[model samples]
Target: MCTYITEPVDLEGSAKGARGWQRIERAHVSFDHPQHAPLDHALEIDLIDGSGARVAVELSAASARALIGAMERSLERGEAETGEGAA
Candidate 1:
């Protein structure tokens, strides 16, 4: 038998030049409108694993914007699903 439990991690980081890691308090999976920020939209997401190791992920600014939009949409879907279920 195999089982797994995973929780999304809250990651944050700044740009390499004229940029730095942005501290985030929380993170949720919801599809909201994504805002495009400047800077070639280059972004790096860093998170620490259970073993206390730092991990970095490179994401394009465009991709990051898309993700935010997706998250917002997820929230929308969740609301719709729950609303219908309640009714």
Candidate 2:
């Protein structure tokens, strides 16, 4: 249920609706925790590059700043992954 856009929402809704979202395999997530992804405690996301292929993106967002920060972090991680694969 994740969408690639500018930034994360206020995310306050999750708090009020936390009861429902608390259960895994049904709630939205900022990123998939490697360990939890397989367990369904979090949603696993595979990025779509608009070119018709799938890729992985890693990030997390607990706040406004962290959302943006995750993007930077994800960029670094993504680049490193791409570099390693290329080599």
Candidate 3:
């Protein structure tokens, strides 16, 4: 079943798509059926640029959790080293 759960986040970064690097301004995160991953449902993340260009990712539940943990750790370490909190 499709949960149809989604969250939109404003972002300021760059994502490399098929056409090369683009300045991403936002992201849409969702949990639903994946278009490519070999799973019934997956965590989907779409990073989008102002011009509508986007880069997409789909990860299984376990992988998603691991990725989140890794991201958190990395961010924390980065902030500690920089002596600054998240912006």
Window of ten residues with lowest summed lDDT in model 3: 78-87
Model 3 agreement with the true structure over 2-87: per-residue lDDT tens digits: 89899999999999989899999999999999999999999999999998878999999999999999999999999999998977
lDDT of 1 by residue, 1-87 (tens): 112222355644322322334334332332222234333334544354333343344456578789879988887899888874323
Ranked by TM-score, the better of candidates 2 and 3 is 3
| Model 1 lDDT, residue 51, Cα | 35
Answer with 1 or 3, whichever has the higher lDDT. 3
Which residue runs of candidate 3 sit more than 4 Å off their true CA positions?
Answer: none
What does candidate 1 score on TM? 0.40
Which ranking of candidates, highest lDDT first?
3, 1, 2
lDDT of 2 by residue, 1-87 (tens): 333332322221111131333211222224434443343223333333223233333433334357668878887899888874323
Give me the overall lDDT of model 1: 0.47
Candidate 3 collision pairs? none
* Error in Å for residue 11 of model 1: 8.0
**Candidate 2: Cα lDDT at 36:** 34
In candidate 3 the C-alpha lDDT for residue 6 amounts to 91
Compute each candidate's TM-score over C-alphas: 0.40, 0.24, 0.94
